[model samples]
Structures are given as C-alpha cells and as structure tokens.
Target: MTSAVDVVVVGGGQAGLAAGHHLRRQGLDFVILDADAAPGGSWQHMWDSLHLFSPAEHSSLPGRLMPAQPGEAYPDAGHVVDYLADYEKRYNLSVQHGTRVDAVRRNAGQLMVEADTGTWRARAVISATGTWSRPFLPATPGREVFTGRQLHTVNYRSPADFAGQRVIVVGGGNSGAQIAADLTLDGHVNVTWVTQRPPRFLPDDIDGRALFDVATARRRALEEGRSDTGGVASLGDIVAVPPVRSARDAGLLSVRPMFTRLTADGVRWDDGSHSGADAVVWCTGFRPALAHLAPLNLRGPRGHIPTDGTRVLGEPHLHLLGYGDWTGPASATLIGVGRPAREAAHQIARQLST
Candidate 1:
C-alpha cells in the first residue's frame, strides 16, 4: 500500500509523539510510523526496576504534563508508557502502529518511506527513531571465549536472573550504577562495577531540570557565537536515586578500573589478578537506530548527519528529532525533546508551504 502526506515521521516514541503534537497544531497531514505493537517505544524494553531520574513534572513531553502517581516520588517505566499512550490518544495524532519502516529514500524530489505495511510518499520526513534497539557492547578480547553469560542493558529485565551469581556491571553511566545496585540488593549476588574512570555523581539536590537548563544555555551561547564555560551535570551522571543512595550508604558503590582484558573465566586486571565472573552485564548504552535512513546517504564521517537545529543541513526537507544533543540541546530526554519537535514541525510547515 502507498499513501502520500505532507510529512512522514518515523518512530512513535516521545520524540515522534512530540513532533506529532506540533505537526497536528501546524495543520500538517502526517503519519507517525511505529514498529511497536503499542504506543510506548523503548520504555517497554527497559528493566522493570528502572525509574526516571527526575520527577514526573520534569519528565513530561510537549504540551501535556505527565500525571504523577500518588505516593510516588518519581515515575517508573510503566507510568511513562501509559502517559505516552494517553498523549497520542489525547492529540488524536495519525499514528500507524506495528509498521516497521524498512528504509527511506528520496525519489523525484519526494521522500519515500518504505515500511512493512505500507509506503509513505511525503514532501518531508522526520526521523525520530531512538537508540534502544541498537544496544552497544564493547569489543573486548576473549569476550567470545567467555563461558558465562553476557548481555546488554536491552536484554536485562530483572536482577533475579543473576541471583547467586558473581556479576560484573561494566560502564560508567547511570544505567551501570543502577543495575549494579539492583544486583547487590538481596545479598545473593556478588556485584562488581568496572569503569574506565570514576562515575560522576550529581549532588542530591540536582536533577534533570538543572541539566536541561545548562544545555539550553550552552545552545544559546553557541548560537550567538559565544563560549560557554558552565560546568553542568550530564545525563550520564548518577542522580543519587534511592536504591543507589542506599547502596552507597552500605559501601557498595565502589568501582574498579576497567579490566585489562577479558578471560575465558572472567577478567584480568592490570595487576595480573583475575576474578571469576558468572555473568557480565554491559550497560554500555546505545547508538542511534538509523538503519532505515541509510539509503539517504546523509551520514558524515561521524556516522551522523549535520543539522541546523533539527533540520538536516544538506537536505532541508529532512529533519531529525531526539537523537542526541547534536540534533538539539538535550533532545533525547522527554522534556528536552519538545522544543526541537516544535521547531522541526514549524520548519517543515514553512518548507512545504513554498
């Protein structure tokens, strides 16, 4: 099946939904293609214990506030999913769920979005596919030879799976710290954290709001051709979540330097000491899900296209939303995505109007 619209948005996650909200407001005829069976995107894949680092008010998408659950300080992954589902319904956005976009290309001045269910021919395309599908696992020597289990954050559901085992949580990000804390909860598993450098932990009072503010300031400074010397916390900084705080209080937050190499049984330290591990959980993060956009041939040496705000520099008709800070200031976060989405929609509307 083939259809045409003013815009076609790929990925119906928070970013795509934010873009949809603006596109609808701009009176653009668009369709948001989502591969998921339901409205929630990568949130559905996160571990059950995962909770937002910021409060509900700070984690909402564009226009609508995320209703905070009673008695909860921060929302869980399920709450976010429910909020996104309701947001899509509230706006009555045109979303084609369960449609996996296979590829996208330009044909005769029109963008063609090929999906499993149909093709979308649009004057412009917005790609918002977030990074959950493409989990990154570093290449370590003897990793393939390891006899124990190894999994990325995407496949990790619960710590019970690693109960009574010796586990190594690798990475110096929030996910790594949180998962490591979870594994040490029941005292059944031995958890060791390994990082190339010590993880940065924000003060107890700091949160996502402060980070967003700093990012916004930095963006504004760059736009004005000025230097920004502000030292602000980043998304990867540990937020001192309850579980993590408890773990630190119990002296479980200590981290080891990265191992020299992986051994069949475990990892070897720089001191030539080896520790046996039953499993290795790599919370090493992800790369953008840009396979569908490969045919566009817009990737630069960094594997990402240059963009002026959300608009692709080389292809004005194409826009990218919520990949990372490069696309827009703090665009990956729920709150940070709204401005970019709104700006992208406005740009798309103006471009198609001509």
Candidate 2:
C-alpha cells in the first residue's frame, strides 16, 4: 500500500528542515523521510572542534537568527545539530526517522517511495540530501596491504578519538585544517597532513563575492552550475588563515603540500615523506549520494543529480536547495537557504495548484 502525501521530503537535515518550514508556511501537506534516528545529519559526525568558517551572522538558516554574543565566534558542528533539533521542535515539522528510502519510482502519476518502513506516495520529492551524502575516498593500489588505521572525516569527531595516536590528516580543505589543528592541541600525537595545494587560508570571517566565486567554481565543476554566495567562490577564495599565522607564531600545527600516493603502510608525497603516523584522516570531502536514485537517470558523470539553476533539469517535481546557489548571495549557508526554500516552495505550490 502507498501512503499518500502532498510532498515527500528526503533527508531531514538543514535543507530538508528548511524545505519543510517553507512548505508549512504555504500550508502544503508533506512528510520528511530520514534514515538517521534524529534530525542532525553530517553534523552528527563532525569533529568537536569543527565550526562554521562563514561566521554566526552568515551561518543562520531562515526564520531564525543564530544566537551569539556580539561579534562572537561561529557555531561548531554540535551547535548546528542542536540548532536543527530546536528548529524542528519550534516549527512542528513532520518527520519519519529511522526510515531508509531505498527507491523512488512513479506509479500512475504518483511518486512511490519504497523504503524499509513501507511505501510512500507523494506528489513531489525534495532531496535535501546535500552533496556531502557520499564521502569520496580515492582508491589506492595497496589499500589492503596498508596496516595503518584509515578513516574518513565523516566518522572522525573530536581529538579525543585520536588522542595518543599518530595521525596523518589528508586533504587541505577547511575541514582538514580544523582536524589537524585540533589533533595538535595537546601535543599528544605527531600530526602530518598531505594535500594538493596549501589552502588559500582566508580569515575565518571574510565575506563578499569572493566567497560566491569560489563556491560557483566548485559547483560548476561538480554539478555544472555557478554558485552565488560569499566565501569559497574561487581558487582565489583560499587565503592565509589568521589562525595559521597565529598558530605558526604561537607554535602549534604546521601545514604542508598534497599527499601524492599510498604505500603499503602510509601515504607518500612528491615533496617528501612525513612518516610516523598510526592513522590517516581523509578529509578529502564528500560526493552526492543518489545511487538509489539512478533509475531516474538524472545524475552526471560524477554521480550527482545534475541541475540547471539548482532545479533538477529534466525532472520538474525534483529540486535541490544547495545545488550551487541559484539565488543571490548566502543561499548555501544555514540562513542563506531560506531564500531558495521560499522560491522552491512557491514553485512546488504552483505545480500543485495547476
């Protein structure tokens, strides 16, 4: 049997929650599908030291402001999780947790979502599953022979997990930087990082179109569109971090070049080898997870649901809020998603009305 609904939202994270909020304001009948036991998605796995680089003012979602002291620091992963928990409760969003959506198919003009719990029938499907749904790990020649412990950044949370363990942090993104910094906080273990290029290392609070350009470059490269936002807009988006300078000045962690290849035991670099690590933290970042949605045949070569202006081009009822910032500035952040949410909701409402 198929359970009927006006809108079936997949993934109950920030994007799903924001989508739900907008749909509610429009008075649409909807339900959120989530595989996790709770609302927080990636934040549930983020390290203890992880915080938003975009700052509190920019990190907020729609309909609510991130509560922070004046000129205060940004919220970390846990803060984001807790905020989502509160957001759901405040708005009374309907969500089905512990429900895994295995496939989505059309049956008699209705979208049928097959999951572990049962079948869900809906007028439309909104995928709040962000690009980070799939964590990307490059396959190495001797991965099986490697004796060192290997883990993705998605599973790594807090330096306590890496305490007393020599760690090799991989990748040069902001997440990698934060993980490396936290690992060296107590000098408990020797930390070595391998990356392709030094991160541009901009100040944590810098805003404006520089951010949008960087985001668009990444989006265009990944999903074939330009993202509109501040922070992380282009290769120029990378800059020297104030913390890097302060950390170097204060004698904390050190940065290095990219990881070249993997040997039987650890990773090797073109520059040289920085050995002495029992574990490798791959902060290489995530890919969009829509393998189950393959029947739709809408994904690109990179395995993401490619879109035009964030709208899943061929699929009219399908839409993505975080797909390269189709709106103006700040649409990718927690607060920024609000504008897109409204636009997407209005679009959905229009389809329903007609």
Top candidate when judged by TM-score against the true structure? 1
Candidate 2 global TM-score? 0.85
Most accurate candidate by lDDT: 1
- C-alpha displacement of 62 in model 1, angstroms? 1.6
Per-residue lDDT over 149-249 for candidate 2, one digit per residue giving the tens place of the 0 to 100 score: 88888888767777788788877776676677767765776788667765666654454334644554554555444443333544343333444445545
Error of 2 at 218 (Å): 13
- The window of 10 residues in a row where model 1 has the poorest summed lDDT is 228-237
Model 2 C-alpha lDDT versus the unseen true structure: 0.71
| Over 4 Å off, model 1 | 230-236
TM-score of 1: 0.97
Clashes of each: 0, 24
- Once model 2 is optimally superposed onto the true structure by TM-score, how far is the C-alpha of residue 315 displaced, in angstroms? 1.5
Each candidate structure's TM-score, on Cα atoms with residue i matched to residue i, is 0.97, 0.85
